[model samples]
Every structure is written in structure tokens, then in C-alpha cells.
Target: MAAQLREILLRTRRHLLLARPGEQPSRLAGEGLDFRELREYTLDDDIRHLNWKSMARIRKPLVNRYNESRQISVGLVYLNSGSLAIGAPVSKKDLAVELLTALSYAAARSGERVSTWFLGADECAYYPPGRRQGDLAERNHALATALEAKGEPADSEQLLRELGPRLRRRSVLFLLGDFMKPLDLSALASRHEIHALILRDRLDEELPGGSFLLEDTGSLRRKEAVIDPAAREHYRRLVREQDAALFEHFRRHGIGWEKFGTSQEPIARLAQYLRRP
Candidate 1:
């Protein structure tokens, strides 16, 4: 199963690298020196790009255009929490690693740098951004080791606190975790383009009818509960309410957000998420 997951991740990386065009250049910034064209200047146009000579000859302000020269960078925040181990068939932590591997490889293949931070409550790991595709194996091994290491319970609050100071550049940041707590990401969004990928298990939202024992991975506390209709409905409603609130928060902050089930195809969901405007 591990080998298969790795293969799928590699295939997805190849697909993303070979097919997707380069990121669209921000109209406000361009690094290329090769002038492409000149057009009438708009109010928002940078005065630095204005062709003063052209304006003097034509009696109109014009802006020089050039292709985007700077490469893209992808920042990843991977959560290593005990709750991620609660899932059927495949654990959420394992799936998260697989998806993260795909994203990192794809970014590197596209000539973009990838910076990763693995967060646990007890410890945190940082991997510097690098664009060399040949270093992927070493990077993947380091990431896997970090995720599997036993540590204190990880939470969104800790992640938010630690991530803010580490972002040295304006990059697209992918924050991956099972969001079980409330988050205020408005401030983080101001410095970086943020995308929140929420990992969930169907069992969490819909419990099977039966008596079952549950354990809190973080606290190591066990409890017995009966999944009666009323209990099940209440659980589902709570999950829905939490998710709805989270969605609204992200929307207001201009951060992209999506929830993916542990059983879903990681690559397909990622592609769908990226395809959105």
C-alpha cells in the first residue's frame, strides 16, 4: 500500500508538471527585461514601468509589458497530530503525507521552490525551500520521519503562531490538517496567499449505530458511548455547523478552503481545488 501510494504521488507530480502552464503573472509585477509591448497607462499602472520617451512622442502615457521572469514558490504547512491516525483503510496522516509529497514534487518539477514546515505540539521541523528535483528523495524521507515521530498533540493555534514569523516571502501557502478548532487566519492571509485543505474522515461526521469504545489519542482517555439515532444526528449537526463556520471564515479572509475525505483520491481533489478561480 505504501509503494502504491508513492507511485500515485509520483504520477500525479508528473501530470501536474507536464500539463499545467506557468502561473499567471501578476499585472503589478514583472521581472522580465525583454519588453513585450506598450499600452495606454491605467491609474494602477506602476510609474516605474511607464515609457517616458513614448509618452513624450505620442502625447500619451504608455506602460511597458514584459513576461514574468520570477519563479513560483510553494509553502507547505503539514500537521502531525494524533487525531490524523483515526480513519479507516488509510490513516489521515498517511494520506496527508502522500498528498503533500505530490504537491512538493510537482512544485519542484515546475521549477518552483518548496518550503515545508512539519508541526507537532512538542516539536517542529523546517525544511528550506529548494528547487532541485533530484533532492526529492531525501526531502521525502525527512518529511516522513518528522510526521511519524511521537510528540505532543498538534493544534491549529500552535501552527498559526509558529507559521507567521517563518514566511519570508510572498508565496502560495498550503495549510493541511484536520481542523478541529476555531481559527482566525485573516492576519496570515495579508502576507501570503493561503489555501486551507481540511482532512476529514466520514466516520467522524457519521457514526455507525452500535456501542463503541473511543480513545482520545492526545489525552489517552477512553470512553464508551452508544451511537443512538439522536446521538448520531447531533454529532452530524455539530460537524456541519463547525464546517460551515470555517468556510465562512475563510471566505471572509479571501483564503481558499476545501475539505477532503481520507478515502478520496488526493490528486483528483487537489486538481479540482487548483482549477477553481
Candidate 2:
């Protein structure tokens, strides 16, 4: 386990080193006083940064961009729900850990203060913001330990309510979860730059025809069912609808997101997402 963690850390470091100087892990605009540039306003741009004078003169909405602070605050939220434990050969939970580790490591290496929160239905753990290498290691160890324990249903409402207040400073928050339930992150998005890392297994969308016994990880309830062609099609349609609604929600609220499968390497996918303009 330690060796694997080391490998992930090394890989993330290498990726960062090879990345172009202008490519940043998070958005560039922040609370810094130095003016970077003025650009046309986009949906993702914070309304608070809108330059009213410029808009009045140009007859177009524009936002002032400020250089990001030397040490930005980064928040990592791991939704340790039992649903994540359900995956194929590689569980969604394992993939989530890898993504979380890479993000935390990258943030710390870039001189950003990293704060981590591990949240389950009935429990929560937090590691305060720190830039030290030892602090990053401790956060990673705690995250691994939490994932190994039994998982419960995710209380996302409670998470939003509790976590929002704890993060006093404006931050770039990354939420890692299966997100099998409905989500409304409008309030949180308004205050912080939010990104959702959605983890899933291939089986989630495609189920083979067979009689099988399935257990609800959240409730630990067992049920027997047969998957016919019709049933499979119905399930797939529902998944598609769910994903469409999820993406729409992200778009409406101006939140960034990416979907990761258990079979894929998370670090590469994450790097690609971070490099987006």
C-alpha cells in the first residue's frame, strides 16, 4: 500500500514537472490584488468580479481577472459512501482515492494549502490546511484508513451545510463521490469554485442478462432479480437520464466536473481536466 501511494505521488510530481508553465491545477483568478487581465464574462466567471464600469462602456459583460494568491486554499471532499464500494474488478472507492491523492499531492507541491474532509452519513473527519510534505502524507494516510472502514449512505445535505461554513476563505473545492443521488450545489458554487469528480464502473451502465442477487451497499439489504433485455434497456435509459440531469445541473450552477471510470487511470484524466482553458 505504501509503495503504491509512493508511485502515485511520484507520477503526479512528474506530470506537474512536465506540464507547461502556464498550465495550473486550478483556476487563476483569486483574491489577490494584482490585476491580471480583463476578459469577456463567461458562465464560469464569478459575478463578484464583474467590472461594471467596463461593461457600461463596452456594452458587453466583462470581468476583471486578478492573479491568484501565492498560496491558494484547496479543499478536498471525499464522500465515503457505500455505493462507491460497488464496482467491477476495480472498485469506485479505490479510483476515488487515487484521484484524491493526486489532487492533494499536486496542490501541496505547488505551495497551495490543502485541507481534506472525509465525510460519511454518520461520521466526518477533517484535516486542516497545510503545505508541508508531512501534512500531505498524514492526510493521505487518514483518507486511506477511512476508505478501508465500513461505508454508509452519503449525507450530502449535511456535508454542504457543515462544510460550507468551515471553509471561511474562498477556495477551489473538489468533491469525489459516486453521486448516485440527486444533488443541488448552487449555494456552495456561489461561494467557492467547485469541481465534481464522479466515479463509476462500466457495470453501472451495462448489466448482463442473468438471475443475480444484489445487495444495496448503503442499506445492506439483499434482493434477487432477473435482468431481461427489457429490464437492461430500462436501467440503461435511467442511467442516461440521470447523467444528463447531473451534467445539466453542473452547467446551470457553473460548476466544473469530470466522470472517471474504475478501469481508467485517474491521474492522467485529472491532469487533462486541470489543463482545460
Q: Give Cα-based local distance difference scores for all models.
A: 0.72, 0.78
Best-matching candidate per TM-score: 2
The predictions' CA RMSDs to the true structure, in order, are 6.1, 5.7
Superposed model 1: Cα runs more than 4 Å off: 1-6, 19-35, 38-68, 149-157
lDDT of 1 by residue, 164-250 (tens): 677677778888888776767777888888888888888878878999898777766889988899998998899889989989999
Q: After superposition, how far is residue 186 of candidate 2 from its true place, in Å?
A: 0.8
Clash pairs (backbone) in predicted model 1: none
Window of ten residues with lowest summed lDDT in model 1: 20-29
TM-score of each model, paired residue for residue? 0.78, 0.82
